[model samples]
Target: MMQPILTVAEVNGYIEEVFPEVQGQYLCEHIAPMEARVRAVVGPQNLRPGGTVSGPTMFGLADCGFYMVLLAMIGKQALAVTTNASIDFMRKPEPCDMIAEARILKLGRVLAVGDVLMYSEGSDKPVARASMTYSIPPAR
Candidate 1:
């Protein structure tokens, strides 16, 4: 079995240090072989005019989920950047916390591809789904 390059606590700590703006709101919950679980607590600022969770908030959760999976498999490569992303808003989310489950479809030397499903906490149906590709920077 392949070992994880980073632990959940490590990834969460890194995000807190590097992206302090999202501290306490977003967190990396778990890391498995090629999968990651992240959560984003719905705050007042994350609500849209219609009182639903904003689309950008869902997108951010998806992106962060995918990034966490990549980092879990490849270590802390902060320079790794998104190359492409597509998101589908399937359902309106509640004003509760959101969870994103990410699965890495492919992990190559130079690139990674993954998909994410976002759900309102305790809900079975997904609120959004996203596919993303990231460009892994060359090692120095």
Candidate 2:
């Protein structure tokens, strides 16, 4: 297994520094070879009319979790952007914090593919799953 280029705390700090607008909402809890664990605190803005977590909110969390795992493996490539993403909403997420566990399926020179499973806080069942691909920019 390859060593992570960034620690969980480092990735969290990077997100805070680069995406301050989302600071305090998303957190990188753990990071390893090609995986990362992240959490998104559910706020009023993330809740829908039915008192459930919105699909867009879960999608955002999944995308960010995948990106953080990629960054942990490849270091800070701010240009490493999501090229495509497909998310399936399984169960209705509770109006609480959501946890995302992301794993990289492939890490090629130009592209990275990953999947994320999101669960509502304290629940063992997954509420959403996302498959995503990212375009990794060439090294400068």
Give the top-scoring candidate (TM-score): 2
Clashing residue pairs in candidate 1 (N, C-alpha, C atoms within 3 angstroms): none
- Scored against the true structure, residue 112 in model 1 reaches a CA lDDT of 94
Error of 1 at 128 (Å): 0.6
Local error of candidate 2 at residue 136 (angstroms)? 0.5
Taking every candidate in turn, the Cα RMSD to the unseen true structure, in Å, is 1.0, 0.7
In lDDT terms, which candidate is top?
A: 2
Give the TM-scores of the predictions, in the order they appear. 0.96, 0.98
**How displaced is residue 43 in candidate 1, in Å?**
0.6
Q: Which stretches of model 1 miss by more than 4 angstroms?
A: none
Q: Name the regions of candidate 2 deviating beyond 4 angstroms.
A: none
> CA shift at 59, candidate 2, in angstroms?
0.7
